[model samples]
Target: MPPKAEYIELKKSIDTLIEEVATVKEQQKTIMALVEQLDQTQADNLEKDKKIAILENRVADLEQYTRINDVIITGLSIKPRSYARAVTPENGGEPAELDVTSTERQVAAFMQSKDIQLDCNNIEACLPLPKRGTNGKPSVVLRFVNRKHKIALLKQGRKLKGTNVYMNDHLTKRNADIARKARELRREKKIQQAWTANCKVFIKLNGTPENTKVLVIRNIEELNEYDV
Candidate 1:
């Protein structure tokens, strides 16, 4: 081959090799940058996953508590009950007598254990007044079922031993009170148009002590005959 021609061919081959090396280096740099970005994204996602797990656990606990507690009413009074005790009490304390038609001590015990309270704010009608017949003498006649039990305990009375009982806005009261007030405002048809304060039920778990929500009813009969 001629020297000039051979030299030209060699120069062309060297230029092609140099261009290939440059292209390889550029590709390597791009790959490294993508790898770093992927690592950062994975770390961010992992952190978000951890936070999501914590939130889910909190939600689960709250849902569990709200499911077990409820409120209901019958006649002119209110009662509360919890399903925590079920049909048995294995504790050493005096066994609670189960009542099928009334809210018994079992409801009280369950509320105490769970730190739940029941308020009668949902009862709207006034206490039944004694009636007089044509004889102008007071006649003793029971007007409501379980009237004797309700009167003796005065569970329907609004005069309670509360610090801010008359206060229009009191949030520190028991959860039941808050719910009852909410219900009252709801029954009066003053939910959205009215300026009703936030009446919410706060719940605390046994050990974790977290606040949650519960629904308020008029009496235990709402759950069952003896749920109060």
Candidate 2:
């Protein structure tokens, strides 16, 4: 071959080799960044799992206490007791107590201690006083305090059937409902991950939307021969 043509061919080969090396370096940087992002995501997911577990256990404990309270009041046939004191000292009135049981008294005291203002206006009407079900089972009724602050109250709670208390079905049902909500939250997180991954790939590929660099590379063979 002629010396001039031979020299030109060698220069072309050198240029191709340089391009290949630059492409490889770019790919390596992209991969390293992806790995770091994945590690951070995994750590965040672990924290979320811990938080969910704590919330689940707390809800279960609350459900158990609520169901048991219903049983106590129902079996005892205790009416909800209330107290009233006269402001006028000259009248010398007595502190009126109702035919409520020990369990009812404890629950009312607990509610008052929590600063949950009770709507005692229709207390008698809202009964079998928040503890009795017409079908003769205990129920956890959601009642409102001061026109707000909705709370769970028990009714018709009798201990029967080998240490099991007959309460309304909603008690166990609430736990299942909460689990469904958690599943939806996890699904949203998956979508967010996909969106983030796309964003990262776009940033690394860096080109105008009209001429993205990743799209310009047609095949693995072209990428290997690319000029950096």
Candidate 3:
């Protein structure tokens, strides 16, 4: 071939290679930018997950604090007030519906009967909780004027062991479920005892006095961690 034609073909081949190299470099830059963006997104998602976990823990703490002054009394039947009933003709009166009294009075009287000595004035509110099923009596949820009053009532609750009534802390649904699981663990001999205080479930594992494990249940996963 002629020298000039060969030089022209070589120059064209060099230019094409340079263009392909530039295109490849551009693609590499684009790929690097995308990788950096994906890395940042992953970091942001991890940080967000951490923040969400922290917020959830804070919310759980706040929920527990709100229940500090609450207590539940179960198996306390509502008693009829002793008073003269007015005869009425609203489809034959029937003792005027047992002369219903204020809930505070009823709760105070019930606690007094149980020897808990709770003052009516110290009770902030009292109401009957909805019955769970068809048979058992509805429980009474009582809010006290202060945490100390609630604590005192709980401390005195042990006296009602042989009686027909029982008392417990007013726990949130999550804590209540945890407490139930803890109790189940105790019944299965996985723990010595399970109890709730201040809306937290506690477990006592069987061990020597020095090694006896007492754990506060913050999540259900903790139950699976126990070797028992």
Candidate 4:
């Protein structure tokens, strides 16, 4: 081969290699840009999720506050008022609405019969809850003017145990589900004891001290963490 021809061919090969390197660099830059964009989107999504979780917690807290000083009386039989015949909200509140005076009078009367005194005036609001009752009755939820009134009534609530009247803390929907699951776990012998107070569910493992650390369960997933 001639020296000039060989030199020209070598130079052409070097130029082709440099062009290929430049193309690879461009592709690399494009890929890096895409990766950066994806990273930014993920960070924004995480921030949004964090904010949503915070708002949800705040909502849950507010719901908890509403039921903190309330009690659910499951078997207190409250008759449908005369409005049951025919009544509208415009004319008057429905039969199912909160008849504060009627509820207070009936509750006070019932308590009087039980020999357990509950001042009707201490009741802030009383209405049937949106839950079905045992034996085709209605479950009533009552709120007290003071937390002390609620606490005192709960202490005396035990006297009405066999009277088919049951009273307990009014729990929010989420806490009620958690409490129900916790009770089921206790019944299955998965835990020593489970009870709800102030809409909070607590469980105790076998051989744990009654006064020791009572495990608070927030969700059903937390139940799996228990060794029991």
- Pick the lDDT winner: 3
Clashing residue pairs, candidate 2? 131-154, 131-155, 131-156, 138-156
- Per-residue lDDT tens digits for candidate 1, residues 50-137, read 8997786466446433422222222222243333333444655645555443343432343344343423332222222233355432
Residue 191 displacement in candidate 3 (angstroms): 3.4
Ranking by TM-score: 4, 3, 2, 1
Tell me the lDDT of candidate 2.
0.42
Model 1, stretches more than 4 Å misplaced? Answer: 64-228
- For all predictions, the C-alpha RMSD in Å is 19.8, 21.8, 5.3, 6.2
Please give the CA lDDT of all the candidate structures. Answer: 0.40, 0.42, 0.84, 0.81
lDDT of 1: 0.40
| Candidate 2: stretches off by over 4 Å | 66-68, 72-228
The 10-residue segment with the lowest total lDDT in model 1: 163-172
Candidate 3: stretches off by over 4 Å: 1-25, 79-100, 133-137
Model 3 C-alpha lDDT per residue in residues 44-73, reported as the tens digit of each score: 999999999889878987997887899988
Give lDDT tens digits, candidate 2, residues 100-176. 44433454553455443444442322234343356565432332332122223322222233333322322244433
What are the per-residue Cα lDDT tens digits for candidate 4 across 85-192? 445677666545444447667777888898887887788898875545444656788899888888888889878978989888898888888888888888888788
